[model samples]
Target chain A: MTITLEPGRPKPMPTPETKHFWDGAKDGKLLLQRCGDTGRAYFPPRPFSPYTGTRNVSVFEASGRATLHSYVIHHRPVPGFTPPYAIAVVELEEGPRMMTNIVGCPQTPEALPLDLALEVVFVPMDDAISLPLFRPAATPAAGRTGVSMGVE
Target chain B: MSYVPGSVAVVGAAETTHLGAVPNLSEIGLAADAALNAMADAGLKPGDIDGIAWVGAMRPQLLAQYLGITPRWVDGTSVGGCSFMLHVRHAAAAIAAGYCNTALICHGESGKSRIAGAQRPPEPATLNGQFEAPFGPFGPPTLFPIPVLRYMKTYGVTEEMFATVAVVQREWAGKNPRAMFRDPISVDDVLNSRMIAWPFRILMCCLVTDGGGALILTSADRAKDFPGKPAYILGSGESVETGMISQMEDFTSSRAFRVAGPEAFKMAGIAHADVDHLMIYDAFAHLPLYGLEDLGFVPRGEAGRYIMDRNTAPGGKLPMNTNGGGLSYTHTGMYGMFALQESVRQVRGIAPAQVPDVDISVCHGVGGMFGASGTIIFGRDRPS
Candidate 1:
């Protein structure tokens, strides 16, 4: 028996509201927007604070530490992903949560326990895109290299 | 204040005759079939429908043209499967206010066959595509269940507890001939049913089928005149939280469900004990858990125990998902329509697996992945 995999993963296209966040990822930094009015951090960066809709916001480096909030070990095969990989949501230490894959660790229930400590790692796809994926904090070297450059 | 409680009634309801696998039919054809069936149930014709509301791939323009009736009111609200519930709510308001004397809300999706259905996965530019999809989730099987682990951790809920939901629903399905998977399934069967997503075995997910359902609404004054007994709309409400599942306010409770459920309860002026039959959308097994608690059927963090007690099973108190729900019954992608259809049947005292002496039936639906929600309460008698 033989198996084939899909060619490439879906890449995020940078829009006006999210260019800075993607740029930060390309450089191996997790960037989030902080609302100037409330001094609160938000994810999936936008031009203004979602809480008050004030343009008083600034981009900053995130500590890249997050707890494994919840996840599903997906078994269905698709073009760009291997079966039985973990698709997860990690709650950033900064308060807001975001979606990312948990790599550098086994994708099984026994291995990926809830609240497992994770840190950020960037996978460069092309010159312009790199997806920010998460990995176990203790074993960053265990997972394969990133698949993209974070830009576009 | 213009909307009156119990001012409108669902005079007719019908699901397309050809459900499960009808390969020859297009999405629009399924909608038309359901629309006509619903109208016939009401003893009505195209000319009798003054307002039309729909949700799905089929545009309302094409539907109006195909049905050959120009409705004075139109609604094409597409939020998810629960969009049909919202349509019913909007149509009820329109009918009560004289915007339209009669309203038709229909849903038809070729979810299983994809006949003439254009695949509209989240775009690369959309929030989902940019943030969630890039992580390699092949849509709902991966996305919808993402909140379970955190929910379990926060509320002491175990996988076995939610898995019991699938078991109990299958018990209800065992009696309904139209249900897709009717065999009595045990919790072990659900746990062992081939994992599609972690915490969600295939049995715990909705069955992909081809079907459509439609409802006809008129003023409560004309309720009993229809061929089918009318189910009066006691109250209805809808609310939204977030487009991105990760951004959901809390992992355990759905903000949309919490908001929509209570609003409907308040509008209906009914308490939890007043509900005789319940239909909570079960696109995935965990939904009923959220619906039960968020709708105030049980205290928070106790829905798991509530189902485990078999309170929602056949011959149990607060009978739920009596048509087997999306899990055991037919799930045509956006299953809110089917949920609404079953609630109407139960309230009209005509369900296939009829619960005895049902007066009020509450149908609750989750639209997106915990993003949008709608609730509708129906009753056998007019509001006081």
Candidate 2:
């Protein structure tokens, strides 16, 4: 059976608070906001420090390094995704977690162990949009190529 | 403040007359049907209900209007599938505080048919839409399994141990004539089922059905007037931790579950050994494992073994998910209502898979991906 990916997958609508992060992804940079007062960094790029409710925050370029916290290799067909792909949550080096897919490795338990080192790879979806997916940092040669560039 | 144990009781409880596939009833219609059935069970009328509570698609006003009643107190606490459990807690508190005399809590979902309306598409700019949605996470099947996988790795929980949950629940399902899928399943059956997500197969997921359930609450003193045997609300607890699964305090343990379970146990002044029947909302196979450990029924990391040993099966010491649970019974998106109904049935000695001489029952629920939790303890006899 020829698997045609569903086209209705959701895309991020860039709001003022989150536009910077999306723009950063387009520029091949992983951007996270740091609270100016507490120096605590957070993910999903919020408007303020969730811990202290401080509006004093600024964006910084992330190291693009993260550890695989947890994931599931979804075999069911989802819109904009082929069957049998990994859906993962990775904890960034800066002490915050973000949801992303782990690319560049087999979507198997043996290949995607807990705390596996991963680096971000920018997959461009459109002229102004790109998504940051993760791949095992050590296996650059195994990185996925020529796949559809859309949300999972 | 700690709850006054046994101040309120569930006078009536019921699910829709026909579960699984009822294409005739819309989501709201199912809610009304269940509410009417429950009211009839309690020998009550629409005018007798002074408070109304519900979660998911149907609003309280809409449900009340459909039933031709205007409630003075209303609760629409949508904390995912466990919202109905929270409704019971809130209704008990409202009844205790004289906010309302008779409280009706209802839940209805057309999860299989999508007849109520298409599922709401997430706003792209919302927190989940921005962070989690972009990753192509496909609802609970994709998101929930991630944590269970981690839990397995951390606790040495094997695939066979996970399959035991589905197998045991199916055993309970086989006994219930109303259960959607009642065929007995083995561990090998669950293991061999088609994989939906890694470490999760078709057997691990709950059934998609269109149904609803309702419960009526009143002061314990008025319980004897109702035709149905009362399941006295001994204690209740509720808590929320996060909206996203990725942001949960820990993948293995749900903070909300930890807080909700012990609080109910403390309020009821009951020990773990006192629980005669248990209903842990089993939307997925791994949920009961978390519920068991978090509710202090077993030690952390031992629930997998506890199930594998047939401790929660039909003839086991602790009868759990006696209505076949969301797994094999009816799951209309929000499954807590059915869990509550089964607990009441077990306490009243009318459950299809009835456990003999049950006196106390605990109904524990998880909303979202461990986002919220509500736990309620029920007793056959009123507290002194």
Candidate 3:
């Protein structure tokens, strides 16, 4: 079958494996799971650890801090996004990488530098799904032009 | 059990008669046409085949019923584009272990025409639908380039170096009459073209086209009865890393490629120096770079410079993507089939832009966004 992206902003359809993640996002918390044994954190949370396959994983609130790893300045128009938005991958401080949008700044190559410090901000799509996007971290060194959209 | 090399040989291989814009053919139509052509090339009928394997827009049962083949073994292993190479690997093992005598593998995709029925979007509950689709990536043009910026920065690769891959492959394509984009193009021409994504110009991406290819394999002892010159299935390996691009292990290289390539090379019992030809699936310009580095064909971060120096161009030390690759040739979305076709052609010394004396040819492909990989090594003669 010829696959095409759906129209409009795609929302998260949380499964049993991801319900807690969405629930935590709705509550304004960036939750991550850590291996209870190894103490290593994981993202896009699952019930168990990927490294050790241990069911002993602990869910906890995160600091919402991350660093920009890589991104693409997509110039083509998709259903939900304007052309030229930054589709970014950010490395969280707790050592997990997640795909998110880089917001609160110009979506250009010059604006989004590698290793830029970032912090998570929740944009609630609906009552159930709140997408956690990242913008420049609110540090004196980084957020000169961009302001924090971090929800209290 | 360890995979022994040279037990099976691909006696027949044929691509669809019409490659680009075959609007008259549905996905199933293309696959059947290629299957029939390969059968004819092998001097056999559909009834002669006892084993069946396939992946793409259609299922094996449908193709089997359409071709009227009652098979003893059926492999529907579909991971991604490189699924065919994995099929080759499994078919060899199946044939070696006395599971099936004569095996047929097939691929067909209507990437551009979309003649096939509408495909369902990734289920919202799946890993990709919940994580990746929400990011608004329209297609591969957006998804594939996500890791390239990190690769360029980490390896100190220049824009000119990246564009050289497209340029070098175009030179090879210029010689192949079947290639879609035949005119010679320059690096600046590629850079100056329309940008699909950051660091990727239109020229750097693969052409969306319609195509299908098939192969017939059997034990080397039975291969002599076939009409086509046998390209021995020397060795093969398959592996996967992640479903989402975010968990690709490293942005600068492919973990799947690193694992699959070495396994194939080790199984083939040949050093890198022994490789006479190569076909690295180029879904995007950056793929060959990652393939080269991860496959150990070049040192770390040397692929960009290597291509820029025309090392992989026509008459270069290593003739790679000699069929113009998915970049200049037709990209049927699942480009691994075309890459396999080229490797078989070069091994048989029948490629239009044929490299001379290709004793060993390596065909490597990536499925999804660095999620899975399959490597196949083909040799001209069966190992003594």
Tell me how each candidate scores on DockQ against the true complex: 0.70, 0.65, 0.69
Query: What lDDT does each candidate get?
Result: 0.86, 0.87, 0.88
List the pairs of residues colliding in candidate 3: none
B314: Cα error in model 1, Å: 1.0
TM-score of each: 0.95, 0.94, 0.96
**Ranking of all candidate structures by their TM-score, best first:** 3, 1, 2
Instruction: Looking at model 1, give its docking quality level.
Output: medium
How do the residues B1-384 of candidate 3 rate in per-residue lDDT, one tens digit apiece?
A: 766688899999999998999999888888888999999999999999999888844488998998999999999887788999999999999999999999999887888898882356788788888888898777888888899988988889988987898899999998899999999998889999998888788998999998899999999998888778999988898999988998777899898999999999989999999999999999999999999999998999999999987889997999899999999988998889899999999999999899999999999999988889999999999999
True contacts kept of 3: 0.79
Model 1, span B71-160: residue lDDT tens = 999999988889988998999988877889998888888999999985677788778888987888787878899998888887999989
Q: What is the descending lDDT order? A: 3, 2, 1
Off by over 4 Å in 3: A1-7, A140-152, B56-58
Q: After superposition, how far is residue B118 of candidate 2 from its true place, in Å?
A: 5.8
